[model samples]
Target: MNAPTSPHILAAAQRPIPDAFMAALTARFGSQCVTSLAVREQHGRDEGSLTAPPPAAVVYAESTQDVQDAVALCHQHEVPVIAYGAGSSLEGHLLAVQGGISIDVNRMNQVLSIDTEDLTITVQPGITRKQLNEAIKDTGFFFPIDPGADASIGGMASTRASGTNAVRYGTMRENVLALEVVTASGQVIRTGNRAKKSAAGYDLTRLMVGSEGTLGIFTEISLRIYPLPEAVSAAICSFSTIEAAVRTVIETIQLGIPIARVELIDVNAVRMVNAYSKLDLREEPMLLMEFHGSPTGVKEQAEMVQDLASEHGGNAFEWAERPEDRTRLFTARHNAYFAAVASVPACRCITTDTCVPISRLADALLQCVTEADASGIPYFLVGHVGDGNFHFGYLIDPDNDTQRAQAEQLNHQLVQRAIALGGTCTGEHGIGVHKQGFLLEEAGEGAVAMMRAIKQALDPKNILNPGKIFQIG
Candidate 1:
């Protein structure tokens, strides 16, 4: 197994946007070019805790050539270029600290191809996950990498995102097969073919998937998709303690039960969702699970998981098999973060993401929950525990320095513990600006040096999404 790479890195010192670059962008994009403070601010920060200076301008790019032309202009002046997808990033991935031009790809959203024969769909980067599935729904195949948010495929590729179904369907790394990227010099390049696997050369496709746009901007993506399951069922099992809920998940995974999705929502999260989404779920540590297979197979999978949970003193699994019922269950889980923050007035959700080996999940999660509770910070717990990944949203009063400090302290300790247990600093959420320190601790100097070398080789001018993942200088 590879040593985990760090998820986030420090924001590198940024250079001022060249005046000539702005003139060039405005000239090239015309009406699409926006330089208003209000527009720039809109393109600046993400859903993360960090606040960065907005870009000097934002250009809506409607085609691959537009991206190349914009990149060319930026490359000419050695200006930074940040790719903007759906603006749904959680790690400040879209912050334009150096102030360049943001290339908004939302207009490029179009279903380019759907080859059901190969079970692959080629799409523009800006297409959201939900839209992609709906477009491909009638074909009997669906894109399964659901990262809770209807995040853009381009952003999802950049961040290497995953969600509850990752345990079964895998993350972006497993689902993404090929890509079309615009390099720093505005060169368009194809990373891989539509083949199932390749050993022809460097796995550039995988490299670009999680490059976080530091290397190049994704213009198109080809994703390997799966057929819709024959039968799907969702359930929830409430546990008296977080330890018990997590242990049940660990046991289920150890036993090789093919559960499609397994999520952990603690008591606070349950309460928030109950009030926010208006669903009266038991306010305790709970496991939200889904099973996919033939009717009998789904039943067996659910039963096996139920027995495992029961052994841990979990309540009887509440089943939600109908489509509407299933949607209600997952919707609450999807909105868990917002619900948590909304539960506390004037609070911000500072999240910590850590994923460990299945063997270490029980201990790792227990330690995390205990420390978070001990800090006396109002927080909610949720996890894609089927894959040994989990998140804690530290709901903090943003104005309260002491509360912020406590949350960061707890997050730091948990990240170190995850690293010790052979887990990545980030499970699904890619490093943006917040986890830069933890990235160093996870990936050693040598590995990070290699990454820096790659960044320099691919983007010599440092024009493409600079100061992300790992800073070049």
Candidate 2:
């Protein structure tokens, strides 16, 4: 099957940015408003293959009021407003598809409040996961939702991002407790609250968690934090084949091992990582795992997983107990995407995120692997396999149309198979411009219509991140 094209792929019309809007933006934000081509260029694109023109202006929002003012100006002028955080999104999330302005929130980085007694922390949207952990390092707690990149908390919330820890800790959808959002018209509204559970009203927090900036801009976020695990141990086990590694993950999850973090890195990705990260690791299909709990509990869990690996023809486990050692191993795993991209100079990656049920993971992954190998497209594979989510980074030279089409076709096939196997086209990366067609394929017409209705109600003008997720009106 040919790759599906997003309806607006080549047809997104740029809306006019009136001089009056610029005047208002300049008057309100002053130096914070930047119209330089360089700055606008930086804000206009994310770490994705899709490209679009830069926004007309970029506003550095230092406070919630600043975001409100900028968004209000855009709303009044009928201009689109795309929220900008760390700009680490893998999909085309930051593209100014229809042209307007970008609200950069990196200046808003701050920890607003931390309630250790309640196991919660309220933070400005700009704070990155690593920074949050550093601020609360002395408090015996850490935020668990890590999407690898030092993505801003707001970006993570917008994408409902989950990472290596998701198998045990859950995604942003579960951990985010409350939000202070600026509506499409610049009205500030709070969704949910610090309370753990509430039955009072619609779950607006849930609605906005993965809205991908289409509904509103997140100004503040409160997240559930977890106490540091009593014992943390990490290990890597190589396997003879990709199926063996994936099968081990499926069986481990089925056996209910409570594995904290289990990741799969195929041979090509491992080779790239070794070159990029300058670490000597087993260049084979490998499972990198971590165990968390009390000392005895961690030991028992590790022993059980080790036995399972051996049963599946996995090599002897290589353990990392020193904190620094464990950090080194995971840091490489997190950098796998970049490594793969850099391996081929001047090549852009079309990454795929497909998640299937644990029982179907082997079938889904093995089939995709076979197809990718047959297609001869250079690719790297890595996954948070414990939760049945994986990524394939297809590296293709930008000038080669045939290579790009091949990568997209591979991505399409994987997403369709994932959907058929009771999975999502996207596990963590939100549906940005690149995945709009996949969203339609997976959600069907009726469900997408409801989503469009919600977007219409929340953003009547379609001024908030217009032309993303789906075409509005």
* Each prediction's TM-score versus the true structure: 0.97, 0.98
* Cα shift from native, residue 52, model 2 (Å): 0.3
Model 1 residue pairs with clashes: 8-436, 9-436
Candidate 1, number of clashes: 2
Q: Candidate 2: deviation at residue 24, Å?
A: 1.0
Candidate 2 runs further than 4 Å off = 5-11
Q: After superposition, how far is residue 449 of candidate 1 from its true place, in Å?
A: 0.6
Give per-residue CA lDDT, model 1, range 221-276, as digits (tens).
99998989999999999999988998898889989999999999999999999999
- Colliding residue pairs in candidate 2: none
Model 1 TM-score on a 0 to 1 scale = 0.97
Candidate 1: regions farther than 4 A off:
1-14
- What is the C-alpha lDDT profile of model 2 across 1-473, one tens digit per residue? 35864322344789999999899889988899999999999999888888888999999999999999888898899999999999999788999989999999998999999999999999999999999999999999999987899999999999999999999999999999999999999999999989989998899999999999999999999999999999999999999999999888998999999999999999999999999999999899999999999999999999999999999999958999999999999999999999998899999989999888999999899989999999999999999998999999999987787788888889999999999999999999989988888899999999999999999998899999988888875
Displacement of residue 320 (Cα, Å) in model 2 is: 0.2
Q: What is the lDDT of candidate 2?
A: 0.93
